[model samples]
Target: MSDKIPEGNRSARERLAQQRERDKGREKRRRTLIVSSAVVGVLALAAVVGLIAANVGKDGDDTASGPAITPSGATGEASLTLPVGASDAPSTLTIWEDFRCPVCAQFENAFRDTITELVEAGQLKVDYHLATIIDGNLGGKGSLRAANAAACAQDVGKFAPYHDVLFRNQPPEPDDAFAKNSRLIELAGEVKGLDTPEFRSCVEEGTHDSWVQKSDTAFREGGFQGTPTALLNGESIFPKKGDEQISVENLKKWVLEANKGKKPGTATPSAAPAS
Candidate 1:
């Protein structure tokens, strides 16, 4: 009945109050810890996202790297000239090709013997304009590097045989394994004396990479579409009018007709009198 509670009762009430405060303190600490953990989780997730984005950006970079293909001034400044046949041959066959192109390989396989015959007989001059359109269209530097090595071979005067070996050892289109410098060097061994130290250095250094790049630019600017583009005296022979396809026989016929009875190795009347 007194205003103050009994001593034992007061002690029990005090203990209850202390226990309730302790429970409240524990709840507050639990909430604080949970919020801190959530914040840390969000930061970690953000860091992971940033790393993924950086990797994607690196993968998408398409900058042209490796080798500089030196433009051979043989056929103007824009072409890598592999002049087969007589210097004064009546007809000029200009070929723009990428080593990685399957059609180019087919074309080589179909007409390589004929090309060899004509080139050996000095009936025609072949100007090979190595282009890396495949690298641009399909991605990767395989075409570019292969073209560069071809140019390097040209430096040692072994371009013709080396070029043949390249086509012979060409890897399938998407598998650019053949483009590696080591493989290229191995292919060079097929051509006698092409595996010299100087030649190896050239291939490894990408000496002609710049030239390969320029050749591609020229190919684009020339407005001729696709690889293995065969031009007889500056005219396209592929993609004939209508549904007709260019055949090896027709290609020979076209060349013969273009020759107009002037045999290979003989100087044209316009250039010099036939003896």
Candidate 2:
């Protein structure tokens, strides 16, 4: 017998080897595709869960349980307004704001000085309406907690200074730093006489949580576009008023115009103490 295999047998052996190699490659590719698909499915599922969590309680389903503890000095409908400046000032600036809202922080930082000037001059009194829209929209309690802390400040007549401190030191939107009572209390130390045991207790206990929720409900029902809704003398003046864009000069002009013949307010009495 010849030592070498026949040529037809050799050809069959080579084809069999090549087919085995091809099958191995196909199996490898099939396994890779299955792993990729599973990873993609998991990521998509996580994204959906995150979205649902973010939107939790936004549908008016999560009402805060307990009596709504209205903050001291809160006026307006349903006791939702936190008034600053002289009560009888010639012009009234109504503002709807959320502590966790970046836009609200921006508005406050930009207009804080001007508003303070007008308020001191007795030309403008501001009605601040608090809302927790960020908590409902972004899945955090910063808005509610911060608003409650501010309300605590109101209890002691320190709302104005504490409000400024909060806006000046506002954290990034997603950080949720204000959600922590300790953080809120720490920030309170910046405001003179605001870091008291009572204030700390109010913040830690969420004394005004229900009130904050009610205010947010009012905002939702108010049909306004979003947070930092600024109205001067019952007319919206943020971003624009009538045909002119809002600027520092425009704001001064608007307040002056509104108070053209009106007398500046005298010193208004302090808010009645909480019962």
Predictions in order: lDDT: 0.68, 0.82
Tens-digit lDDT string for candidate 2 (173-271): 789899899999999999987887888899989888899889888987787766678899889876568887666778999999989999998878586
Cα lDDT tens digits for candidate 1, 112-215:
88877776666677888877755655567788778878877777666778788888878877787755889898888899877888778877877777767767
Candidate 2: lDDT of 88?
Answer: 89
Q: Which residue runs of candidate 1 sit more than 4 Å off their true CA positions?
A: 1-73, 241-244, 266-275
| Colliding pairs, model 2 | none
Which residue runs of candidate 2 sit more than 4 Å off their true CA positions? 1-57, 60-63, 271-275
Worst 10-residue lDDT window for candidate 1 reads 266-275
| lDDT top scorer | 2
Query: Which candidate wins on TM-score?
Result: 2
The TM-score of candidate 1 is 0.68
Candidate 2 at residue 125, lDDT? Answer: 94
RMSD of candidates 1 onward, in order: 25.8, 17.9
